[model samples]
Target: MNLLRSQLGRPSRRWAAIGIASAAVAGLVVSLSGCSSSTTPKAPENTVAQGQWPSYYPSDYGTIVDGAKKEGGELTIYSNTDQENWAPIFRDFQKKYPFVTKISANNLDSDEVFQRQLSESATGNAPADLLATNAVQAWATYNNEPGRVMEYQSPELAKMPDFAQVMPNVYAISMDPVGLAYNAKLLGGEPTSIADLAALVSADPAKFKNKITTRDVSGSFGFTVSKGFVDGNTDAWASLEKILPSARPETSSGTQIEKITSGEYLAGFFISSAVAFPAQDKAQGIFKFVFPKDGTVVLGRGIGITPKAPHANTAKLFIDFLLSEEGQNAVSEGGLTAYRDSVKPAPGRHTYGEIVDQAGESAVIRVPYKITSDADVKAFTDKWNGMLGK
Candidate 1:
């Protein structure tokens, strides 16, 4: 079957949809401050309160906004967050802080964001105000790299449960659990486990061959999913080995779901709800998604300020907004499962924290395991690549 020719839907245009909505806001900042983003600070020593962030009122938030406005309201971000997912968030932020005139969000997937941070380091140009990404690449790139990420203990930190903070510098903005999606019209039987997926495929390998979809473990979000699978369950890899032969590798959940919608593929494993939720609504009832009982994959997507961000105050404001109840509301509307449990549950899907509650703690495997075992990550990646016919 010619996958390309038979395609009926294209991937979501999020990557190309960066919102250039800050020009006016930027002008306002310039008019107000007569200062450039260069006025923003460089290191922690130059920073204000390190941990006393998002203060209740006049003391903290007011100061932050005033500082941000003076810094030119221009904040650039490097993240995998899609335009459709983040546009509302950024817009809402701009509405709240009209002085923020320049908000540019570049749509880079996790791997690309990680690599770019490195490139910036080499050239000594860390322009991004913030870094938003999954734990896999985020931790790999910033956690160990001593001075790369900034530590802002936003008062939002005090509200979040200790576990929600991925690391000292990184805070979980939202989470997208790996959902099992199958063509609704094509597969009627609800699968409760990965073994069920394998059995279904084993039953009809011909139809399933090259028709199944999963993260490409060689890179992208797949790298984290692969590692999380091994760390979570011993039997997970065995089930994947059963399905990999017929599965087509896709680095993106967006493309995988497009294939699933188009009938080029029938199912997608470990797909992000951020992508799946949008596709489900856009595909007109063609897709059905559920978390598996054996163990569902959960990716905690987080953010942190940069060490030498050009718009440090603006970046902090953005981070504060992201962790705020209002900002998280925008997060849910964007499609991904939200991180904050306090954020009221949406109509159809609840916050991922609640989802985890309903699924039972034992049934969920949070990806980017807290324990970063390099040897284990290496072993799992190697095994996954080998299974994928590398």
Candidate 2:
């Protein structure tokens, strides 16, 4: 299937003529004689003129299309992921909606995505049109604040799983799994689980000492991933006790992937597939990752439109597009796991369905999107820090 033409079909000659005439009437262009003189009128900014929308999409979705066009086609996003990761998604969105003239996306830490939004909003400045991050606790807090998130139920919701709708307005943009990463050349054997890594470290404490890396559990991203894995597996803490002494904690998945690839760290566990999978493609043959045989923790990167969105209509269009099948494919191409069952498979790309198939449904533990009380966080952090000898 041609990705470009799939969502937006060819415009009929009749509609094309109508579009041109409308533009002429609006003074956007003037035609003389049988010859055309001005730049071609922008494609009609409605569902009928652009192409067929999904059958399941609401019939009134065209209103959103028209509203977005009037908003000057500008969108701002606050997310924890790098811009490079959003390149393919942004490109495809622009192709589908050519009138979207500008998009500003900022890559920030998970907690900072909301922090910045709150700060900006408090100062009477417009905040992001959309917010996306894997910080579960941060999301819970942000959602609790009145008027922070726009309550929108997208037309794409019908096709998504129940879990995809994390909260009233928030939805999962990607279902990313956390796994073990290693330097294939430096590690003697492929470690498939925490137990396997524990055995390796126990056997050769000196060699593996300070060569293992994992996330620092103090940060939101780190804490959520670490806690998710530990809570899901009964023996996780037991295995980490044998392994953590030999491990160093890092603050970000990018750092963990780099260290593993450089052989600075022989192995890293609970590393995000979203960041690791793309790098593994360029690691030659030294870097590899495995979804633990014991269990794999899947975390959803949640997204929602802000209540004070400067371009609210444009934001709505973007949220719907991201949840659509075409958007899911673009997301996978951009190095994030696409969960839609309809998305086709590609090398190095994975879907939530594929992960469940490979890992077994029982072994694929998903972290629920909910608030973590301060007490619970402290208790978990204390235990995790204690194991690390911090």
Best by the TM-score measure: 2
TM-scores for candidates 1 onward, in order:
0.78, 0.83
Q: What tens-digit string does per-residue lDDT give for candidate 1 at 1-390?
A: 001111112223233323345443222221001111243322111012322334463464667767887896678887766555565566667766766666777766455566677788689887777887774554554566577788777767666656567777787777778778888788646676777888888788777878788776656457666567666877886788888888777866767877887888888788776656545655667887777766788877778888888888888777777777667776665555667768766443337766566556787887662544557556766676666522
lDDT of 2 at 64: 85
- Cα lDDT computed for each candidate against the true fold: 0.65, 0.74
- How many pairs of residues collide in each model? 4, 0
For model 1, the stretches where C-alpha displacement exceeds 4 angstroms are 1-61, 121-124, 202-207, 347-350, 369-378, 385-390
lDDT of 2 at 369: 75
Residue-level lDDT of model 2, residues 295-361, one tens digit each, is 8999888999998798998898888888888788767766678887788666645688777776677
